[model samples]
Target: MNFSEVIKQSNQVCKVSPDGKYLATCVQYRLVVRDFNTLQIVHLYTCLDQVMHMEWSSDSLFILCAMYKRGLVQVWSLEQPDWHCKIDEGSIGLVSSRWSPDGRHILNTTEFHLRVTVWSLCTKSVSYIKYPKACQKGMDFTADGHYMALAERRECKDYISVFVCDDWHLLRHFESETQDLAGLEWSPNGCVLAVWDSCLEYKMLLYSLDGRLLSSYSAYEWSLGIKSVAWTPSSQFLAIGSYDEKVRILNHITWKKLTVFEHPAIISNSKAVLFKEMEKRAVVGSEDLSVHQLTVGNSLFSTQSKYEITQLPAKVSVVKPDPDHANPKIGISAMAFSADNRYLATKDDNMPQSVWVWDMQRLGLLAVLEQTAPIRCFVWDPRRPRLALCTGNSKVYLWSPAGCVSVNVPVEGSFQVQSLFWHCSGGSLILLSKEQLCLCYMDTEEKDQSTSSDCNFTI
Candidate 1:
């Protein structure tokens, strides 16, 4: 409900620490660390080159800045400003770099997916992992930060390797049933590892912590199978988005399809409430003293938006993707579960401007959000059963079981929200624009987290 001054960011690399204390953002070759609550600069450090990627260590004590083109990674400690470490891959080349779950170990993958190098800050030792596969999401660490599952490609066969993060030892290595492993993720409980195949195969397999295959599932014998996957906070249900423009919920016990939700252009359901965003230009008033609020062509006060509950049987527009395209845009590309695991929100690529929310208890659609622009990103509040989403516009939209509301980013100049991130406390949000970023402090004092039979998601 409130906003902070816009801060300039060079790259799209901005992250909040897991401890919800510091905010890190990259500007050209400088890394700026600020206090999350006060937005005051606490520390500033220079990097070797332009920062291509940036992340915070799990403990939130250190920050890592990576320059892929230069094959360099720089780590800075907040407690000891002068104590900084730099890891240079030299000519070997560095394609990806990240921190291990331990917050002390750094993992750098070489170019061409040749190998992974693990650097330890505590032990000052180096460990090398071979056969690292080049995929979208090939590496994942469990929630407890104890184990890591890595997808590997060995002799034309797909494999998975589980390693203990304490010493980076190979605990288990086994061949995967996937023809081409696309992505893999560990459940929130860290009990099961879910691996899905490429767009060509509609196969999904679940494996145990010890590399034993637990379950296999396939929705249909079609292409562009699984686009996205999400596990409930409780890890009781696994939601998989597929190319068929549907989301299939699988129970943790059976891992079988418990229910399927489809996105139809025509919505005639009475149980679902549809909130459509409407934008209109504000009529400039001749309030002589307030002329300072005006800009050259358009300013923050130029236009405003609001959400109106539209009548049922509404027809939403859909953009059909070309079949010959490399990555067709016609599937359920995004999904998120509420922190309480009571609601599920999804976005279908074909209906770019729509977001659907489903109820897990009644197992039905609750509300539908139809925006004027494509839904860029949506995330659930960590503390409650609320959802916040952003379009490539100057406003942020939110939905809850109680109702829906759209708030404009009160700022001068054009600050279109490209994406958004929520603070761990869910009391504030970091809204990123083209080259600017701002923090949105939510007004939770007046609002209560009470839900009625009718919620904020539409079918």
Candidate 2:
């Protein structure tokens, strides 16, 4: 299938609307809403200033934009323009921003500095936090909004600092003298925090969100830098992706390494791995196109069952004697597990540009999707199990277990596909091919068609 005529340009930071009917993208001064089924730009917005990022309100009637520049944060009521508000500004060095789970507050840094500020959307008030070092990234509000985790960088060392946001109280800090920090994340329940290092040694620390030191573990010693990290929705385990072509699932509380999944170098490019949900299981995608799943714990460290690394095809260049699996061979370039945790999909570096989907519960093969040239990047629908694969030929294929649909989208005159994102609400699908961002939806006939949508695609 070819997607050349089906794509549309979305100049905004696009998001799926809450109900799965519309796609929203933020352009220079506006947040544009499009019909998901039509892949058509339906509504246009004019949001002033450069919009850094935009997130939807729980109800879908409002959109929040974290724009760069001094002064008030912007809140837009889609139905009522007058209800929008611009929040007060704070210190410099604020490089990132995030919303609290309750959608009541916004957490952002002061430029590139170490201090974090919490802004109360309701009160329009701001609170500042101080960290020991300048931060690289990883300041996130837990799903409950009670806690925030910070990964700060100081020279070569990185510190994982946890804080109670309600009172701006310091909870604990995970530090290492030998390794520099790379990233940090909190489990869904806000019970456990995983901290990874940038050093060659496989170094990661798990901390209890309540300020307790839970445990720590390292991957095989290739010094392949840890690239990405994620926690299962159930909170029982953590998934760490590394440059070593392996993704390891660890018991959150016990620090026991449970599973190691190997991907081929071509698919993974030996970059990173991430976990997505499908039905009741967890789907993990690697820099290689290899994806797999296992049971998830409702609580941290719920799985202690031993597992050997399941080696993928020979195309996946992984070291032999991988402690976890024997013969793993799915080289993954980009991947995402469906939100329901049922389907695990991967984009491979191979020809025929394909996206593969596997049954999470069965942990076996399900379908192989092909449309254009080698799949460069793709994302799964966060609200549904659909897969959107972008290819090197500058094409996009919307794939499901049933079949594949193509959308050849280009933003302005851009060529190769760089990234693709599925809106969490299922209202829109975003394409980042080359430098420009394009938003798309199904044709007009599909606009009102409702399916079990629960996937998110992102570059």
Candidate 3:
């Protein structure tokens, strides 16, 4: 319950520095840098117009930003804050911004256009490639950095365009017939790409990096659209979450549906799949307010196993599992979790809200935290079980088994925080709001100083 440092910005988009020393963000028409140790804003460089998106170069040397109103992209050196370069796209606005894995160049999209322009900072040159009439919403680079997976959003149908990164050449395109594309991600080894649709049931199409439709899987019994999809670190299994509040484990290579575990309620989104070390199994969360742990042998999907599916009810919201902890119930949401995983922190969409932690492990109830306004979002710090709750009242609360406690922090007024993410690497806790990203970290005096870290798994 002790977050003593603050990094504030005007814009909503912010990216942590690769090495975790500093944070680069966009503010009121400017780029700002803040020191993690001192919790002080050190440098600020104003720009001509509002920056749309920002990305840190792979080498951590430069931060490339796309200025929307200016219709230009610029790269700034972190070492020499004054040194910056700008490239023009000869358009009205900027759409997307990304850096190659090598950090040698960048890719930018023009407003409402199907063309993506590649900019080389070193050579000061730009290359353009056009695609079908669809705006690319999300994009990812391959592990080798040779190919790109672009998520193009059309009217009712969605498509993915595979292009060669080196020469900006179009390789192949895949179109969906049943559902709209919900999410796109490649496997950790860059071998397979998991594509989900937006129907009531979870449907996925796995394709190779070379644009080959390897295999497809569908759940006709479950009527939930694929909310979220996660691939294990080892790339051996793929976890799919559906509206039926069930998570199915599949074999990545064979595309076989192994087992499906049902949650208590309708899962509004796809559940994130992660490897839990304590149980040495897979942890899956659902919108019905439950998390399940299932053990699958290396060849279990190919054959059969005795480990029947077991699910424990969890808090339902736009919640994310605690990446640092492997415990089944230790998670972060816009709510809370009890000591024995029986009580969960939760709130509704109305005002005069009450925070309740329902105990699912013991199949019972725990405690309730009283609040004035509606509690919008929350998370229980895995390192600290006391729940951190943010409400529509514009306040953040830290509650424990003892009683109600408050953490010393500023009330973010720029925009309401929509989500909370505690970096497993241990630098700072990120608050994703509507307008700006508020980064909360520990002050230098508090004692435990853990470095923030991130895993590089695809999908």
Q: Best-fitting candidate, measured by lDDT?
A: 1
Q: RMSD in Å for candidate 3, one decimal?
A: 15.1
Clashes of each: 4, 85, 29
Provide TM-scores for the models.
0.94, 0.65, 0.62
What value of lDDT does candidate 2 attain over all alpha carbons?
A: 0.55
Summarize candidate 2's per-residue lDDT along 218-296 as a digit string, tens digits. Answer: 6567645565565656676566666554556676546798765554333332222111111122343323221112234
Native-vs-model 3 lDDT?
0.56
Supply candidate 2's per-residue lDDT for 361: 62
Query: Candidate 1 versus the native: TM-score?
Result: 0.94
- What local lDDT score does residue 228 receive in model 3, on the 0 to 100 scale? 47
Query: Candidate 2: where are CA atoms >4 Å away?
Result: 1-12, 19-22, 33-48, 69-72, 87-94, 132-136, 152-159, 165-178, 251-255, 264-335, 342-374, 383-385, 392-394, 398-418, 423-459
Higher-ranked by lDDT: 1 or 3:
1
lDDT minimum window of 10 residues, candidate 3: 301-310
In model 3, what is the error at residue 320, expressed in angstroms? 22
Residue 266 of model 1, lDDT score:
91
lDDT of 1 by residue, 16-75 (tens): 999999989999999999998898999999998999999999889999999999999999
